[model samples]
Target: MSNAASAQTTKTPGPGTYRASCHCGALRIEADFDPSAGTTRCNCTICTKTGWWGTIVRPGAFRLVSGEEVLGGFSRTGAGYSHFCKTCGIRVYGHGDIPELGGEFYSINLNCLDGVDLTGVPVDYLDGLHDTWEQLAAAPHVDPVTAAKRLSQTS
Candidate 1:
C-alpha cells in the first residue's frame, strides 16, 4: 500500500452516532460518541436502580429526535434532572448543574443504546450509594480491586 493509503487506513474513525430509546420506545435519542471513549456504572440509589452510570456524554453530543412531549423530568435535592418517558416510566437521560457538587453533565443510559458491543470497553463501577458517593462518582476512575471482584463474580 502507498504511504498515503496506509496513513488513511490508520486514521481513527470519528465519533460515530448511535440511537437510543426508552423501554417503551416513546422517546428516541441520538448521540455521537467514540465508544472507545469508555463508559461507567454507578452504585448510587437512582443509578443503581437504573443500572447505569459513567455512561454520560456531553449535552452537545446528544439530540432528542422524538417524543419530547412524552418525556418527564425529576430531580432530588437540586442535584440533576432525570428525564424519563411518561408512558413507560423509563429513565432516558439526565442533566444538571449542581453548584454544590461541582457542575453537571449529560448522563446517558447505555442500555438505551441499540447494538453497541461493550465487551472489553472498560467498565468502571462506582459506589454511588455510600456517604462518599459523590467522591467516587466520576468517570475514568474505577476501584481496581472492587471492579475486578465484581466482574469476577458476575462472569
Candidate 2:
C-alpha cells in the first residue's frame, strides 16, 4: 500500500473506542464500536434495578484492561455473564452466546464509559422482561441490528 494510505489508516481508529470502569475504577474495559449504533434500556428486572445502559458489541471488539482479580460475575438471566467489580460492586459489562443471534456478543455498559455522549444516540426499550423479541423488533425506536444482537443473550 502507499505510504499516504497507510498513514491515513493509522490515523483513523476503526470505529471509536470507549473506556469504561467500575465505580472505583478497579476494573476497566475498552471497546471499539459505532456509538451511533444507539443504546438499549431494558425493562427486565436486573436492568431496571441497575439502570445500566448498553450497546451490543462483538466479543473480539471488547476488552478488559485491568482488575481481573477484582472482577466478578452474576448470571441472572442464565444467558449473560453479568460482570462487576468485586471491590466496588459496580456492574461493568456482560457477555454471552445464544442460539438466536448466530453467536456470541458483548453488551458494553454505556453508563461506565468515559468521554462518550450517549444521549444523542438512539435508545431502544427492550421488553426483555417479557421476552417480547417480536414486539421489540417492531418498535420504531428500536434498532433491528441491536435487537438481533441482544437476542443472542439467554433469558
Candidate 3:
C-alpha cells in the first residue's frame, strides 16, 4: 500500500476504499480515505451551485486510477480548481487554500468518496460568498491575502 493508503488505517470506516465516477461512468477514480474525518462546505458561488460537500486531504491521499484522459477542470475568479469528468460533467474534487477559506486545511469534494460512512462527520460552513477578503484573511492561523491571491491566480 502507498503512504496515502497507510494514513487511512488509523481511522474509522476502517480506511474506506472509495470509487468515484462521472454521471456516465466514463471517468473513474479510486481513493482510500477516512470519511469520518470532518469535511467542509463552502458558501462560495461555485460551491453553492454544485452543492459540494468537501473534505480536505493531502495530494498523496488521492489517485486517479483511470479516465485521466477524460477529466476536465474549471476554475472561478477567486476559487480553487474544480475537476470533473468531461464525459458526464460530475464535479469530483477541488483544491484550495485553507484558513482564508475558513478551513484549517485544503478542500476536497466528499461526494467523490465511495465507501466511507460520512454520517458522523462534522461539517462547518464558510461564508465565502459575502465575506470581505480582509475578514477572510483574519482567520486565526492562515494568511488570507496569500490565499486570496492564489485563488485569484488559479481562477
> Which candidate leads the pack in lDDT?
2
lDDT of 2 by residue, 1-155 (tens): 33223221222223577778777877888888976656677888888898787788888889889889998998976877899999998898999997675579989887777544343466777788888843363222343555676688844
- CA-lDDT, candidates in order: 0.67, 0.73, 0.60
Screening candidate 3 with a backbone cut-off below 3 angstroms (N, C-alpha, C), the clashing residue pairs are 137-144
Compared to the true structure, candidate 3 yields what TM-score? 0.63
Better model by lDDT: candidate 2 vs candidate 3:
2
Per-residue lDDT value at 119 in model 2: 33
- Tens digits of per-residue lDDT, candidate 3, 1-155, equal 43234222222443566666556666666665655565566677878898787766666666676778888987775456778888878888666655555543334566655444354456666776875422222112222565678789999
- What TM-scores do the predictions have? 0.69, 0.74, 0.63
Cα deviation of 48 in candidate 1 (Å)?
1.8
Those runs of model 1 whose alpha carbons end farther than 4 Å from true positions after fitting are: 1-14, 98-104, 134-155
TM-score of 1: 0.69
